[model samples]
Target: MTDFISLRNISKCYSAAGRSVFALKDLSLDIRENEFLAVVGRSGSGKTTLLRILASLEEPTAGEMRFRGKLCSPGNPLPSGMVFQDARLMPWLSALENIIFAFPPRERTAELHEAAKKMLETVGLSGCERSMPRELSGGMAQRVALGRALIKNPSVILLDEPLGALDYFTRRAMQRELIRIYLQEKKSFIMVTHDVGEALRMGTRVIVLGEGQMRKEINVDFSYPRPRSDPRFQRLIDEVLDAIGDGE
Candidate 1:
């Protein structure tokens, strides 16, 4: 498979209190087309910063990124769409309208509406098109956000701790929903999550970020709908935790 996304020698730094804080240092990664990759890390480990750079939301202090073998430039419509930790939906807009917000307003208004509604349905929000963000539950709101991201039909999807705020059941349900979408859409997915188990369950490959760099990469190599109690899955979780220097 071809490389859909590539990052070479990427680094980011911010000056704080007359000192420099290194968020990422010399990180290099390649995401193959249609691959589902998860990045797991502790707070301040630079996972979010890496995703921001990939999404073109922030420029890296050093190194380069390429999309579809083309050099990525500033102001480029990133070959990807992003979902943040919060739903970030406009409170006044209905679910369908929020998804439509990303589309260009022209003769395609009706086409965009149809696409948005289809995406909402794909995310399992079929009948909630007219629902406002305030009227929806947290999981429902996040589903709307997912619909918004998918409606754009980007080649890659960047999820920045998007499932972090949900309760256990909702979070698990969303994880399965995300996996289902990944399989159905076959679009590359790069998610930054702190949940190790979720990472193990969802990612075909898991990358661990630690101490200002990517510390480990583990391939799950298991079939989909992975069971939580499987020995291999549990072992992978322990291994990822150990990579971050965490104890059992």
Candidate 2:
């Protein structure tokens, strides 16, 4: 199948005290439909930058990014949603309100309310409609964030260090939740994570980056609920580690 999204020689630069610093240089990627792509790299390796560029939160300083062969820009944003390490939920709003917040003021009608309510249920936070951000646990709050993003009915979902803040148990649970959501939603998911195990567990394809460049791309042919105990699984992890120089 053809690529759903393409980034051709994309580069991003930052000006620091009149000094040009490159966050990403000559990075290229092709994202397909219904894919779970995981990006792993050390800090300053531009994993987050890549995700931001895909989310339309940041622009590439050079080269081009296209969704379905059309240039991506503010006027023509990608059909996608983004989540971050922090849930960033509104303190004052309830769970349902937070989900509906994704829609424009003019479109947040009774119908959207029903849709938002359904979305809350979709993320497994049904009865938490009236729960405030402060009232919910870390996992529940993140669920609300996911709802906000998914309520847009986006074709792709970009996540940056999602589940990084949760406890180990919550993180594992959320991982399962993510898989369930992905299987049901059938949306492309691009996640930037520091956890190799997490990436192996969720990603259908894993890309390793170093010094703002693509170092390797590994295909994970295994099924969902990946067999971490399998020898092939360990081999892939070791290979990714080697590519990342994490073995050191």
Candidate 3:
């Protein structure tokens, strides 16, 4: 497939104490449509920085990004949805209202309410639309956040540790749910996670980053619901850990 989104020699730098900090250094990547691309690395390895740049939340200090074929910047960000570690739901809004909030005020009609209701069902929250964020469980709240992102129907979805705060069981369940959603929506998904195993399970392709540069790229050819005990899966984990300099 041709590149759906392309980043060419992208770099991001920050200034602290009159000194420069390089978050990403000359990184280039291509994302294809209908694929799950997982990014893995240690803290400060630029995984989140790259996702931010892709989301157009941050501008690259150098280089450029092209979506489809046109250049994109902070002023003209890509058409995409983003989910962070925290659900970041509005405490005052019900689950249904939170999703309706994705639309502009003028667009929030009765029809829109029906659409949001469908979205809640899509995220497996059909009966909980009346619940507040505080009332929902961590996974359910994150599902609401996912629903909010999906309601807009963007071509790409950017996930930054969206399941990081959930318990082990919930996290695993969310991982499966994410895989299901990615396949059902047939959209490009760029997810950044610290867990090598999670990356292996969820990504069609995994990119390992170190020191703000691409260390390795691994293609996961197996089907979804991959067995963790499989030798191939374990080997891929080892390879990614080695790429991240953690396999020693």
Candidate 4:
């Protein structure tokens, strides 16, 4: 359980209306190998900013990150894939094509199609390979997006509210799908979500953020398909809600 990725004194700032705005402040975290880490907070809590920094989509204003003991920055980021709330698939591409689109054109070998097909199966969408984005259900389209990320064979996967668009049952199903993929791929999965229960159910460890800093950390310390009715589970949820300043 070594550190796969480490952030040291990370910070992000911007100037708005002639005033400095800090999106993240002295936020430090260590992501371990094969662990599912969930980040929870209310709006403007810096959750998405943290994920963006990890993905190299945004550079931190201060501090640094290390991946596998090597320094990482926007120019030298961790080998990772990112999935957004929207599937963001090309409107004209089929499921198979969407997964293959992850690679650059020159890297799109005949072998890549087979790999994409395998990834589709991995995400539980084997027979829907030829289905167009418009033809797939919300969950199915999101699964294709997941396959697109997994096909890259990244060391870590960053999820930014990827299931927020789904209905209740679909969201639950996707949660299980995500866990299954996490175990099977053995890669670090870092997700940002507003749902406290969702974080408690899926994360091996949960980190709570408020006003750009971590307020609390909790360990699930149990097996998957977490029992929501268990008193321990309820208690942890309560603790997390309180940490987020929403407990009443």
- Model 1's lDDT to the true fold? 0.89
Better of 3 and 4 by lDDT: 3
Off by over 4 Å in 1: 106-108
- Pairs that clash in candidate 4: none
Q: After superposition, how far is residue 80 of candidate 1 from its true place, in Å?
A: 1.0
Best by lDDT: 3
**Cα RMSD for candidate 2?**
1.2
Q: List the residue pairs that clash in candidate 2.
A: none
lDDT of 3 by residue, 1-248 (tens): 36579999999999999999999999988899898999999999999999999888889999999999889976778999989999999999999999888887976676888999999999999999899999999999999999999999999999999999999999999999999999999999999999999999999999999999999999999998898989999999999999999996
Q: Taking the candidates one at a time, how many backbone clashes does each contain?
A: 0, 0, 0, 0
Candidate 3 stretches with Cα past 4 Å from truth are 106-110
The sequence of per-residue lDDT tens digits that candidate 2 reaches over residues 34-112 is 9999999999999999988888788889988889889999778898888889999989899999998888797667789
What TM-score, over all chains together, does every model reach? 0.96, 0.97, 0.97, 0.97
**Model 4 per-residue lDDT tens digits across residues 1-248:** 35678999999998999999898999988888888999999999999999999999999999999999899966788898889999999989999999999998987787898889899999999999889999999999999999998899999899999999999999999999999999899888999999999999999999999989999999899898798998889999999999999888
Which 10 consecutive positions of candidate 3 have the poorest summed lDDT?
101-110
- Against the true structure, candidate 1 reaches a TM-score of 0.96
| Clashing residue pairs in candidate 1 (N, C-alpha, C atoms within 3 angstroms) | none
In candidate 1 the C-alpha lDDT for residue 58 amounts to: 85
Pairwise lDDT winner, candidates 2 and 4? 4
Cα lDDT for residue 119, model 3? 96
